[model samples]
Target: MSNPTVTAAQANKTPVLVAICLAAIILPLSFVSGSIATPVISRELGGSAQALSWITNAFMLSFGCFLMAAGALADEIGRKKVFIIGVSLFALFSGLIGFSSSLIWIDLMRAAQGVAAAAALAGGSASLAQEFEGRAQMRAFSMLGTSFGVGLAFGPFLAGLLIAHFGWRAVFLSSMVIALLSLSVAVTRLNESKNPNAAGIDWPGTVLFTAMLALLTWGLMEIPSKGTTSVEVLGLLGATVVLLILFVAVERKVRHPMLDLSLFRYARFIGVQALPLSTAFAFVVLLVLLPMQFIGITGMNEEQAGLMMMALSLPMLIIPMFAALLTHWISAGLVCTLGLVISAIGLGWLSQAIASQDMFAALAPMALIGIGIGLPWGLMDGLSISVVPKERAGMATGIFSTTRVAGEGIALAIVGAMLAGFVGQGIQQLSLAKDSHTASLAVQRLATGDLHQALLELPSTNALQLTAIYASAFQHLLLWLAAITLISAAIVFAALCLKTVPTEVSETLCEPDQ
Candidate 1:
């Protein structure tokens, strides 16, 4: 006979689970919509290209950097409390950003929004770990992933509709409603959790790590304009390295490290880390880049560009579930590796299709990329902590979330710099403008799809020539992305399936419980 107490406990978890899922939906929806809203925001606010970039960068940077700190704080104090606080602040900041007239105010609020996101994701996911166990836990986390998938799948189209009718501010403001809902649900339904013996956080390490990331990102952002070899860029990069070494030293010595550095010792854990970073470079970067390509370069309107992006994100809704089911039949590592391979193939196909200058032709490859990425994307949250012991799951979840979001932010910046650099080189080679300064201006304008302004700056070039060069640069970038994805697939497969590993490790890594 079933005990009433046990049945009651199980029933109570449902509302808490729903709240966590809602929180999951809020951030990813914000991420995609913010990208979709960027150009429109730029048009209205009239900021310089450098300042305009903060719309995405500021949020990602703060969100990425503070994840570990937030997770640690959650463990020490209370998970549900931190989560509620984070969601509430995110809603407030979204409203502030939406209403602000100045770029500086908007950017500051965006950064604050990111910190809140970090707290919510880290606290909420960790709380999820506490609420469920074993295979049930995996399914619950899968629901979490699906929530993220839902946001990615529908965010663009929704943002487009909102932009078309209510204006771009809706993109930011829309997230407020979601956040408030998630917050209210969490406040009421979720039970607070904490670690009894958890030590204090390593504030010094946290500060250094955040600073290192900020410096590295700033250096990358400067690369397109200042050139990689510029004194300022070099100094920032150097400082970044120094800070990283110091952060490592502090983490090694700290009584309570933000990330348990030794977690990297497990081959499977290392492989799991690669999964998020791979998806970041291969999938997340494209989320930002593809929409810009569709809207800026090809002159598609918001709705049209959002529709084009559907081919890229729509598969996410279904493919991740398919991937989860397939793991029961085959090694999870193999499935993820295969997904990366498919995505690499899609990237190559995309590059080739770009040569045709046909948007519709590119759709199939975009879908292919989405389908491929969905496999790995679905499994990441589960795999992140499965390799580690339950006792360490909070730190594991924190580190994994940090890697995924931070990697996305860093990859986006790097790819942006590379694309701009490629366009700059193409401009000089094509002699689009004789003056170096004029060519630089044209490169900046072209990168943002301000082709009209670019042509005005480079009077010598016609529309056809600039378009061809842009296409060529884009093609090369896609190929590079494809190559990186392929290499990561091999590494992840090798690490996860290593025969030298212990039997228990191998079973967990390759044959996750379905």
Candidate 2:
């Protein structure tokens, strides 16, 4: 017969679990809808390429920058209180985004939405950790992962349908309804939880960390336009390094540190942390790039492109349900390592298929990528929090979420820079080969993703050559991405294979503070 204590504990956990899962679903829905609507928004507002990029980057940057501080605040004050505020702000800003007539206003609104998301994510994850333990905790986190996967899987398709029927404004406006639903559930169900003994917020450390990330991201985004060595880029890069050093120094000395450096001593924690960064650099970045390719290269309409993306998103929804079962049979570390390896192979396959430029040939590889990503997507959140004491759940969730979003943001900047550089070089080379100024201008237009304009301007002879050049440049970019992904897989494998017993690792992670 079940113990009364254990039974009562689980009964109490049920509502909290539901509330966190609902909150988890909201942020990804917001992000993916914005991604799907980017092209339409850009055209309608007559925004520049940089402005278009900012629409997405602004959200990611603010979300990542504030996560640690939000996490610390949740621990210091109360998770439920912070979460309610976050949901309300997310709903408000999301509605404001839909009404904006200018790209600048939209970007500002997106950044504010991201800040709200940070608070909700950190607080919700912490609340889950506080309410569950051991196998129950694993199941709870897996459910949260499944909810996130569901959001990603349906976000684009839903956004497409909304945009098709009601226009791009519908995409942002739709989030308001979701936010209100989540907010109501949270208020009714979630128990207030916090670390009562946790000290005051470390404002200095927070400022330094935020400044470092902002500078690093700005420098990366400027690389394509200003060149790596330009004064603006170099100054930002140098300042980022200095701020990082200062942030580390402050965290080390603070009584209530924002990030606990001691957590890095556990090899298991290190391995789990790498999961987000590597996966985001490879999988999340591809999700963004592939949709653009579908529209620009394959001549697919928005709805068709969103449908094709299902080849990548559907498996994410289905496979996360199996995470707990898989963990029972295999170590979480081994599972994550295998996932990374599979993702690398899938990326290589995708590179080849993209070079072929046959839409049908790409679908199978897209499914492979989906399976690869899905394998570890569910396990990562569980592993990240499980390795730490319950009291520090907010900190663990913050680091995990920060790395996840920051990795995606950084990868996007790097990939954008690389694509622009490759296309520019390809255009210059083709111009010299053809010896026609008109052909050069046409290729330049293609490089900027104005494929229709480029085709209109190109002479028949130059059109074929320019298309070939563009394809070659794209193939080269994908190959580089694949190589980076494989290297990340190797690193994950090595980290997880360290010599340590499972019990010893657990003790190291969960030992009480000195």
Candidate 3:
């Protein structure tokens, strides 16, 4: 009576390749668009740089804050339903953003987009995890990484082309198109995957946690644009600190915490979680800081600088193909640690090349940084989800995304502060140079471009002297970044030693719940 051919494979639903493509379309657009679209939008509306910044920051803050709650919701309500809701909300707000005339409207819509993105993003990884297992799971994770990288790599360049051809409105409109298409596919193709036994949404904890993240992120964003000493800025920072404490207290008392405070009990979970956080921090800081250095100090034009910046994404695109293959034999921890070490080396090498203005020479080190970023980041989702219960994959994925965005925001604040400090030092050194009068003139001219401005400002009689001063000061920034990269390497290495690789534990952890 039994059908011999009815293996799990025969019963399994055919994987929807379109879903991955749909996910790829929406995954990193919000991030790339949020950061990349601001300047054009601000200029068109005659808004301050600060207003442009808030447009991006508002989205990041809300997106990061709600991720955990979205994950919890996905688990309770079903990923298919939650994803549809997120997509619909995302499309509606994205349309609002495209036509908005006011800066306030743009910021609010961006925030709404963030909320929708949080839900969609949280479920994306979980959907893949639930749909596939064993070799299939590995393939799904690898493909998921590729999808994410494609979104990230393409987002800015795509936005640039659209903005140039169609204007800033095109960027938001594109998101809407992708969101609607994805939503349609998901509704028709994806099945419900809700765990009835999973804990319900933790409203109190979610509110407190989101409040804490928002306060902290807002305060961090202020440090760059508004000096740290400003009364209002300091007040925000103080509020963030207090809210964080309260958030922790609330989580401990909550029956179902949005963030499971007890997850830290697993040393492995802590390490896996920390890897994504640090990797995101390092990558974001480098992305923000490096392009300015190339444009300001190395004298690349905007387009040239943007192209050079592609070196970061290049390795990300290629390394994962090899990385996915390696994962079958290599422990995820080893691969991730190797990635971190390689990135540190690349950044360290980049530090040494600061004395040279050649962009070609800079490429090698930067390409290495890209390789480093791709390897670990690619493995992170798999490693994190593999450790948690299958029923809780949505929640875990949500926390992973939250940490990632939070790290990104934190990196922006930290690196922005460091860059300001470096520039200030460069100015001071230029001012204090022996040929002070001529150097001051050149420093003023630095608004044009680093190399040419320095060349122009230095007296023909003292050209060499001034050039040396500029190079010396610029190298200091390089040295500082190099040091930070090494420090990051050490942190990663320590985390690796403290945690076991997932392959060793995957079987035990992946055992289906009774």
Clashes of each: 0, 0, 0
lDDT of 1 by residue, 1-514 (tens): 9889877877789888888899899788988888888878877877666677778888899999999999888988998888988988999999998888999998889899999999998889879979987766777888898999999998888988899889999888889988888877788788889988879778999999999999999999888778889999999999999999999999898888887898888787888899999998888888887777787778888889888889999999999999878888877888889999999999999998886778899999999999999998888777887777666666787888889889988998898888888889888886668787787778877776667677878887788888888888888899999999999999989987665454544365566556
By TM-score, is 2 or 3 better? 2
Best by TM-score: 1
Model 3 ranges with Cα > 4 A deviation: 1-17, 288-306, 327-330, 352-357, 386-396, 427-481, 498-514
The TM-score ranking, best first, is 1, 2, 3
Worst 10 residues of 1 by lDDT: 499-508
TM-score of each: 0.96, 0.90, 0.81
lDDT of 2: 0.76
lDDT of 2 by residue, 303-406 (tens): 87788888888889887666446766666666677777777777778778777777677888778877877777877776776666666555676778888887
Better of 1 and 2 by TM-score: 1
On TM-score, who's better, 1 or 3?
1
- Residue 56 of candidate 3: its Cα lDDT? 63
**lDDT of each structure?**
0.86, 0.76, 0.66
- The worst-scoring run of ten residues by lDDT in candidate 2 lies at 505-514
Per-residue lDDT over 46-89 for candidate 3, one digit per residue giving the tens place of the 0 to 100 score: 45434555676677778788887887888888887777788889
Sort the candidates on lDDT, descending order: 1, 2, 3
